[model samples]
Target: MTHATTTDGVRIAYQLQGQGAPLVLLAGQANNHHWWDQVRADFHPARSTLTLDYRGTGDSDKPDAPYSTELFAEDVIAVLDRLGIDRADVYGTSMGGRVAQQLAARHPHRVAALVLGCTSPGGPHGVERSNDVRKALAQPRPEAARQALLELMYTPRWLDSHPGPHHTLGDPGMPAHARRHHLAASNRHDAWELLPDIAAPTLVIHGADDLLNPAANAPLLADRIPGARLELIPQARHAYFEEFRALAGPLVLDFLTTAPSRP
Candidate 1:
């Protein structure tokens, strides 16, 4: 329910929980802080968590102006500064990972450790999603599109047994232009050259079955980053963090707790 005003005048909304060292959890594209609902508890007792809504997502202000991952990083910094947090560990997935790249590269002193999940370094060097997945994602029908996304997110076995709720895109009230702007920002993210400059202890994790962001990019991200570790969850898809939260969550926690702030 708390808020921070970014330098650009956008109102960024965020929530803080738990106690001990600070750990900011960044959500995927068009998603708010709630994207970490399934895993935040995993970090409890060890690290406090901060989750914020991106400019056009969740409870944050949505302006018609263009957005980029770099701007999103600044928004995060403004919130940290507002709260008087000097440095923290950061974990980001999907679009948020792109923003983390900017944060760590541009403000190395501000990050203690970093974890990027199911994300890619965009630009010409990044591998694009398969045409099949892209076409299914293009389905205009809401119900059909939801099913398609659910399929991409989890294996049939898990979906058949759990049949639980899942989050999609941003708020139902988000304007069309904001959604377009979010997609454009993610599409434009290019941190390949900047990856080497990231000094935070880092881990790049992804799903081997991911079609949205090919698993190949995970190695590329790990290889480019000075000493980033790479992990791929077999049989997991785009939503590996959720589909295999039990596994993915611990792996992240171990790396964060054991790795030195910088090498």
Candidate 2:
């Protein structure tokens, strides 16, 4: 457990685990470093993993102001800088993936490789969520919202077979206002025009059944980024890493460990 101060004086909480080359894990909207708990072991031992709580979530400061993808990217940079890590592999899920896009585009030298999971580039090319899903996400009660989220995030089979032990709501969880701010930040994220600027070896992974971001966005992201590869997990939903860790884990580790081809 450690904290890094962003340029704006916001204290960002992050954790460094295991040993080997640094591999930063960025969580989606409303999620903190603990979101990666389910799959943390996948990268450890072979690679040191850095997990962080984005401002407005977890132990990080919540300023109650408008948030942007670029701002989140800078917070990530602050964590890396404080740790004295000059370069590292990055894996971002959902909104975290959006921030990874900006980081790779705006600060190419800092990223050695990139993995984008269950996320979108935003703009016209990206698929919007259904009204029902949005409404469910906006529920005032955390339990109700979590129920709504489960339907959109996992397949029925996975949920039926493995139930309970679910993550708790509140405190470490995102508050209503913070969730709104994160959503607003996500809504404004548009990296379609900047994809071509990414020079790192990139991998775009998505669940075929993801409703929030949709699977169609994966191909678009792969196409826009030069030499990017796309991988889809069948019958999986938004939280494939959690529901299908056995498969998603190896794929991510292999991509992050593989050497990039010289031009």
TM-score, structure 1 vs. true: 0.97
Please give the clash total of every predicted structure, in order.
0, 0
Model 2 TM-score, 2 decimals: 0.93
Reference-based TM-score of each model: 0.97, 0.93
Q: Write the per-residue lDDT of candidate 1 for residues 149-256, one digit (tens) a residue.
A: 888878899889868666634456667888899999999999999999999999999999988788899999999999899999999998898879899989999999
Candidate 2 per-residue lDDT over residues 1-263, each given as its tens digit: 58999999999999999999999998888778877887888888589999888899888898888889999999999999999998999999999999999999999999999999999999787888888878988899988987877777888888898785544122356677887888799999999999999999999999999997789899999999999999999999998888889999999888877849423
Candidate 1 lDDT score relative to the true structure: 0.90
Instruction: Assess candidate 2 and give its lDDT.
Output: 0.88
**Best lDDT among the predictions, by candidate number:** 1
RMSD of each: 1.2, 2.0
For residue 207, model 2's alpha carbon misses the true position, in angstroms, by 0.5
| Candidate number with greatest TM-score | 1
